[model samples]
Each structure stands twice: as C-alpha cells, then as structure tokens.
Target chain A: METGTVTTANPLNVKAKKESKSKEIARKLLRSWTGVIGFSLIILLLILSIFGEVIAPFDPMDAQLRDRLLPPLTDGHLLGTDQLGRDILSRVIVGARVSVVIGLSTVLLAGLIGTIVGVIAGYYRGWIDIVLMRIVDVQLSFPFILLVLVISAVLGAGLTNIVISLALAGWVIFARVIRSEVLALREKEFITAAIATGVPKLQILVRHILPNIFTPIIILGSLQIGTYIIAEASVSFLGFGVQPPTAAWGNMLDEGKDYIFNSWWLITFPGIAIILTALGVNLFGDWLRDTLDPELKGE
Target chain B: MSDILLEIKDLGIQFNTGKGPIQPIRGVSFSLKSGETLGVVGESGSGKSVTSLAVMGLLPEKKSKIVSGSIHFNDEDITKLSEKQYRKLRGNEMSMIFQEPMTSLNPVFTIGELLSEPLKQHKKMSKKERKEAIINVLKQVGIPRAEQIINEYPHQLSGGMRQRVMISLALLCEPKLLICDEPTTALDVTIQAQILELMKEIKAEKNMSLLFITHDLGVVAEMCDRVVVMYAGEIVEVAEINELFDQPLHPYTQGLIHSRPTNNSRKSALYSIKGQVPRPEEIGIGCTFANRCPHAFEKCLKETPPIFEKGDHLSKCWLQDSKRQAVMK
Candidate 1:
C-alpha cells in the first residue's frame, strides 16, 4: 500500500532509492551509542565462549581449600576464588559456552519448528488454524518455569535435555508471532498470484511465505536468545538444567548464594555476565527490529 | 478462434458468512474460444474477480464454495479435478495475472527468481537454460535491459515494469489461456495503456485466449472481442465489443458508459450511477438491478428474468420476455 511516488515516476532511480534507504538505516543504527556497545558486548561474549578454555588462567573446577574464599586481586586471581577456591573469572568465562550455545541452539530449533507450524496454520486456516492456535494458547497460558520444571524433571538433568525443555517452551512464541504474520500475508495479491500460477502449496509456503516472514523470525529469535539464556541459567540453578560441575551462570549464582554474606565476588561476577549478555542481546534485537522494518522505528 | 478453450456451465458460487449463505454467482454460464478475448465488466462486489478466482481454483476454501458448477478447460472438467490435477494445468496450460502489479509479485524475490519459477516447476530446464529462457521471455514482454533488470527485486521496478514482469512470468509456459483480472486497475492511465498494449501484443503472438475482467468500459472496448455486462453477479447482457459499445444494452451497462467523464463534459458534472449495488443479503427473487434500472415495471419487481437470446446477443430482462415480444408484435 505504500505508494513510492518518486520511485514509480522515474524507474531508473528505484535501485538507487533502495540503496540509499538501506544505507540510511545502517547509518542510523551505527550512530546509536547503545547499539554499538550492545553489539560489541555480544561479539566479546561470542569470542569468550569459543575461546574461553584457551584463555582461562586456571582450570575452572580445580578447588584448593587452602586458598578458599580468596577476595578480589588475591594471589593473581583477577576476579578472586569461590568457596571451593575455583577461579571465579575462569568459571564465568567457561560458563559463557553453556549459556551462548544453549541460547542459540534453542532459538534455532524453536524458529524452525515454529515457522513450519505457523505457515501451515496461517496459510490453511479454518480447522487447522483453530487446532494449532488452541494448542499454542494452551502452551502459552501455563507458567513458563512450571512447564520447564516439569519437562526437565521427566527428561532428567543434562545440557541437551535442558535445551529440549527450553526449546519446547520457546517454540510457542515463534508459532504465535509467525502465524499472525502469515494470516495478513495470505490475503496479499502476490499469494493469490502464486496460487494462480499453479505453484504447489508446499512450494508457495517455502518460496513465497517463508522469505517474507524471515525478518520477524530473526528479530524474535535474537530477542528470545537473551531470555532463553537467562532461562537456561535459571534451570541450571534449580539442579534441573546443566549439572553443577559444568559451571552455568545460574548454578554459579546458586552456589554463591550460600556464601553471599561472606564471599560477595562469587555471585557478583556471574550475575554481571547474565546482566551484560542480556542487555547487549536485547539492545541489538531492538536495533534489528528498527532496521528491518522502518514502520517499527519510533522516530 | 473456432476451438472452444474454456467453458463454465451453470457456475454457482456461494459464500457462507457468519450471518448466512449468499449466492454471489447464480448459475452463470459462459465460454471462451481459443485466441478470443472475453471481457467481463461489472462494478465492485459484482463477482467478476470471484468468477475468475473460481476458474483459477484460488477461491478461499472455507469461506467461498462452488455450490454447483462445472469448469471445462480444454476438454478436462477442472471443477472435478483435484488440487494435484489443477496444479499440473496451472502455469502450464492456463495462467492468470492480477491487478496491483506492485502487490502481485512477491516483494522479496528478484524479478529473475519470480520469472524463473514456472520454468523450474513445469519445465525441466537446467539452470543455464532457465536463465536464458527467463531473459528471452522478459525481452518478449518489452522489459528493457532484461539482463540487468532480472537481478533486481520487485521493489526496484516501476509499476509498469513490474506488470511487464508479471506478463512475462505468465507467458513463460506459453499457456493456452490467460485470465487477467483488472490487470491495469492499479496503475496510472499511461501505464495502464502501456500494459494493455503489451498484453495485446503478447496475446496475439502467442495465439492464446484471454479472459479480461475489468469495470472500465474503455478497456473492454480496446482489448476485448466480446463483453459480458454483469449486475449483482448475473450476466445482464453479452454482445460483440463494437455492438455493445454502439448499442449498449442493459440499463447498467448504459449507466457505466455514460458515467465516463469525457473531454467535452469538463464544464458539466460527471454523470454518476444513482444507488449502490445492493448487498448480497438484501438481494431477493426479483431482478437485482430493478431498483437502479431506469425502466423498471411491475413485473421487473415481482420476478427474476431468464436470459433471452436474440440473434447473437443475450439480455436478461422482462423486456426480453415472450409476453413483451407478443405485445410488441
């Protein structure tokens, strides 16, 4: 419905118009200081996750009772040691591996599953829409942590099991978001045109519908990554997520809670990691939403 | 032109709204011969587009139902065909182009990809062959610099160019019939003219039948060989293009032609039709256009009229009845 009068009048200017429009969005995103900081922090966390073990000064699990509860800047421990004398800095850095991996994998799994269901339900409405949406509603209504707790309890504790639990919780969000988008797009003339062309239903879903809805999926996935990471940490803290020795941020916070009045550094460092990662990913997601769809940009 | 390409026999389409069922197209029958262009003209909600969608098998499954109909396309009864069977015929044997060129081509896809889809689906062409064929078709449809424009997306083209791409895409498989539903309704007048010219040329070169649906009588005059004037979903009159324009039958058709603003009528108020098309729910047993018709009588309000054949032309009105004929005689 957007009538680009200038572009339509002079056909030759269309390509240039698109180029400048994208460049303008890119420039605006780059100029936002929060976006830059968020982008940098996310990159830093990714590097740490990939190279954490190589960069850590000491083994994360190595505990020496003799050096237990060491304060900050004691005996070359940059961030000091926990109640078990394991390096706090080493543990947090290595813990990034679990958080980032779980966050990204859960998002990927949820996005794929959700998009397929959403496209099917949205494109072929009536009974399919009713059934799929009702299931989504049921999933959404139940408490997030409650469902995760129950699933993790049944599945037992492990990284993959944790991923599956979170993914199951996560897919509903994507399905709901994408289904609404598909509903609007179904009435668009291009979809009818595609159907008229004799393009198979599956082919139309893949070729026509999926690409158009990819922007929203990417934006939602990026934002959900932060939420899922925090959720993964929460699960791990409850002993239903990653087992203790794996060093997840949630359990690190849990371990530090017992020694909180005494050793503040244990919780302080891991808590910062969650806050910083969440902050960065959230800002970047906001920027992505603005950049992909200009209509969403407040200005 | 003698060969019958498509036939619609007593096509009855009904929609089940929350309130009740409304039969939009009631026992409508028409046919298109090979290489002949048939124009269906009507106002908004006249079921012109719905009829076309019915032919394409693109009607919404849950909302709209073809209650009773048979669509025979090249000897195959498409109404009885399954979705899979329709798929094989679509884009290969018959294709359709819609109004709003900007919205009709997927915005995400480059013109190259959009154009090459039919080839990939129906034709077993390799990548290189497909590219070549796409470029060839684009050029045929009058897209300048087909090589460069092929890589550009729909948002990067003008309305006219996008329409050209649509035409080229529809023509890729050399379909025997092309149904264009108000293909020029969304473009500017000049662009509409260009698109019509392109369609006219392509249609001639391919020797294909065209079912053009539009409300613009001028377009019908320019492009169609025969015109079907419809009111409230029923065909009121059917005649050769020149004959219809010269001696316009059906009060609705006359109203449409007179409403067109001409250069000579700049000082005077543009003529307008009186009442809006009655809603489907309000339409009853009597003639749908009786309230709007300039010459309605006691009988026109009481009973619906059957289509009366007079030589090559057909008109559905009490005036075309046997009693009226007897009185006149």
Candidate 2:
C-alpha cells in the first residue's frame, strides 16, 4: 500500500504458494479407491450396530409360531425367521454391535499394552531386553487358544471378559512389531540427537520413536480387527460370548446350531454375517499394506 | 600442546562368538593430542572402526568387548566407566560421525530438530536459544538458508547435506574430540572434498581433536595431520601424513600407495591386492599381512613383526632386512 516501496517477496513463494494440487488430488484419489469397498462394509456395520433397535421390524425377542422357518424375503420376515420363530434378519443386523465393539476394544486394549512393553524392551536393551524377551517367549509358549479360553473363564463371560481375554492374548504382536521398530530406531542419529539434546528416555519413546512406527501399527491393527471379530463370534457361538437373549449374533448362532438340521436359516444367516464382515476387513487391511509399502504394490 | 585429549594404553578388543574369541585389535596403543587430527587408515576389518567404537564405549554388548584397555580422557581412565557415565560423555565431550549418513541419522526428524537436539538435551536451552543454536550450527556447516533447511528431514537432504548435518550434530556439543568413522565414503568426489574442507574448518574453529577413520588414502592425504595405517587389528605404520606418503614404510602401505588408480595407465588394468583381508578368526600368530605380501620370506610367515621405527615413520614389514639385501645386491 506504500508508494515507491520496492517490495521483495519471500524467495520460496513458488513452493509456499503450492504447486498445482494435482499430485495431492491424484494421490488421494488413488488411495481412496482401494479402501472404498472395505470402508463401505465397515460403515454399514457401524450404522447397523448403532441403529439395530430402532430399525428392526420385529421386537428381536418376539416369537411367532407360524412364522417359524420362514425363508428370507417371505411376508413380514425380510431375512427369514429362525427355528425359534425369532427374526433372523433382526438378529444378524443387531449382531453388528457385538462384532464391531469386540473388534475395536480388542485392538485398542492390546495395542496400548503391546506398545508399552515393546518400547521398554527395545529402548533400554540390556538385561532388560533379555528379561523382556524371555517373557515374550514364555507368553508365546502358552497354548494360544487355551490361554484365551482360560483367561476368559477366570474373568467370567460377558462383553468385558471377552475384551480382557482378547487384549491379553493379542498384545504380543504389537509388542514384537513395535519393539523391533524401536531397536532399529534407537541406533539412529535422531535417538543420538535426542540423547545429545538430553531428551528424557520417556519423552524419546513417546514423542520420537512411537510416531515413526505408527504406519506398521496401523496396518497390523486393521488386520488384527478381522481376527478379533471372528474370535468374538466363535467364543459367543460356543455360549461363552454375550449371554443368550442379548440379541448377539454369536448367541443367535448358538441357538440356530441345534435347528440347523431341520431349518438352515438360523446357522446360515449368522455364519454369513461373520464371514462377510471379516472378509471385508481383511481386504481393507491388504489394501492398506499395499498402499503404505510401495514395494508390495505392482507397478 | 602436550595436553592429551585421549590416551589408550595396551588396547585390546575381542569378539567372543561361536567360532572363538576373535582378537581383532591386540595391544593397540596411541595418544590423540588436543586440537590435532589423527587418521586411522586400514583395509576392511582392520579394527580401525572397532578401536574407535571401543574408545567411545559404543560397541554392541552381543559380540564386541574390550578385553584389556586403559582409556585415559582428561586425566580419568574412562574404560572402566559405566554405561550411564559413558552416555553422558557421548554427545558432549566425544561425539562420533558414523560411516553411512543415510542410515546413521533417523529419517523421521527435521534437520533443524536433529541439530537442536543435542543442545536441548545437554543444555536444556529455551526454545528461542535452541532455534538460534540450530540455525548457527547449520550455517556453520556452510548450508545456505540454514534457517529454512533446518526444518527439513534427513531423506529430504542429499548425502552431502546429510553428512554436513551430521558434522553439525557432532560439532554442536563443542566436544573435545570428534570421531569421524568413514564420514565421506558414502558421498561423491566433489562432496567428499567439500566435507573434508568443512571438517578442517570446523576442527580449527573448535580446536577439537579429530580421530579420523577412513579406507581412502586420498582422503588421508587431504585431512590427516598424522596417519596410522592398521592391518588385521594392529597399527602397521604410524607417522606424519607427508612422511608416510612420501616414504612409504610398511609393505601394506607400500602396496596401497602403488595400487592407487592414478598410478596405473588407462589401458592397463588397475592394481588390486591379490587376496581379501583375512577375518579375525582366520588370522594366525604370524604377521597378518604376510600371506598376502609379495615379499614374504619364511621368517615373515612364522613370527609377527614388531612395529619398527625410523624417524617418525613406522613400518611392520620383515622386508626391512631382505629388501635391504636385495637392494645391496
């Protein structure tokens, strides 16, 4: 605004002003495509889990004698009624809540515990590394299923117990991944730089190392979610999951197991739900792994 | 001139593995004068790196260990110091620049963040002081627009730039000694010259002793004030750079000087040593280089040669007698 003022602009004005956002837009579009199918499936389950009660036509617990063994798309039963005359459609749709919750909780809990153990084992690395590694070896030696089942039994079955059992058993994966990452990163100049600068050990782990290893954690976490969902459903199907009449898909699966002989809808419907949900998550994880690591992607 | 920055007496580093205890460096002794640059030149696996790592107390606990050594630093025998004490000195009094700058610096941090890190940790400087220090260090390394560049990450910088950043990090602490471990091997020729010049300038500015470890003879000629040629974990030759280069003493040093690419013609194939440097386990009681030496006589194969001195130039070759006889004939 001042007259006769020779104004020299910032030298990096070209870079700062932004190159044609074409590359960014293209990268985003490319990244979004592979994740779309998985995202839709996840979003659908989340929506169904949230709105199960409000949207179901029948009171999920209501019984109709005549509607028993009704095939899918029959009058009043969109996904068919099970052997108990309970709505199969309502049960599977509501089953989304337990599956989604189990998937999220297991990952969150396991991830938190695993990261802490891994960082400590990796960072200090002396007798600490040796002792921590021994613990990991011992944990791995426990019959994985037996360990989870025992843990679950001791804790007593409910949503919380399932979450606890899963978290305890699943923590080692995150621990191992994060530990290796920290080991490699600890040798790096940034760590030396951190130490040279006198950044505290705790601060180095939390701020420096953890943020860098986040990509692998994300990829592994997504895959682990699929496994957790299947595990939750299996335990529940065995009658150890959500107690019956809770409208859980696994308990519905347990109820339908006996009648699976005469009527196919009970087992088929819930079984299909677990399979489809797990499949979607796995596909999503695959996409993320490929996207995050360009080496894995075919040119 | 006499104040010793580093004095290592009877230094021996051994690696106990499945094979046996591999003694790569045996009874190695040297003193680094304050504000002087000392070069440790050697073939691969000559224990040049191992010696420096041993001095820094940075060798991995899995395999490498100081079997016997007394490392006196600032009048204190620090070889017996604990990890905690060593860690305190590492980025402060004696910082090291590693061989591969690409893998040495963590790729995640901005260059400015990396540069300021030592200041923040050791000094606990305020944010303003940290920023100013980082800018100053970056500028000290001759990086233009260092203020803008400090915010960049390792991968964003070229190999030369990364090495400079490393130098800045090493020099940041105003350490009494800078251990440069093959610092320029990974860079291009032009970058190597620039880095060597930068190192010379910085060492002068800080008046710090430099323990320069390298395999390149040319680099030694340029940056080294005194040269120590190592072979199979022992000092085969030690003297002033010009003294050793002008009148090469050790047979190994003689071979290295002769084998330089410039010494050979365009059509003629370049001279390469006939065999690989022997691994520690494969080495016997005799002179380590005798098996590869063209002038090796029967005595040379059976007994180890002592470090022979003539003026400041030292040589460990049995050729001293046999070559003299051949010359007289």
TM-scores for the candidates: 0.93, 0.88
Maximum-lDDT candidate: 1
DockQ of each: 0.46, 0.29
Interface RMSD of every candidate?
6.6, 6.2
Q: Top model by TM-score, which number?
A: 1
Clashing pairs in 2: A196-B118, A197-B117, A197-B118, A197-B121, A197-B122, A198-B121, B112-B150
Writing each residue's lDDT as its tens digit, candidate 2 over B19-76 gives: 7788988879888899989999989989998898887776766787888878998878
**CA lDDT scores, all candidates in order:** 0.88, 0.81
Per-residue lDDT of model 1, residues A156-179, tens digit only: 999899999998887999999999
lDDT string, candidate 2, A1-299, tens digits: 11111122354663543554456534643677656677678778888889998877888888888778888888878889987688888888888898999999999999989888888899888888788878878888887666777788888899999999988988988888889988988887556545543356687787788877887889989999998888888778777778877777778888888877777888898888888889889878877777765244334
- For model 2, the docking class works out as acceptable
- TM-score for chain B considered on its own, for each of the candidates: 0.97, 0.94
Deviation of model 1 at B79, angstroms: 1.3
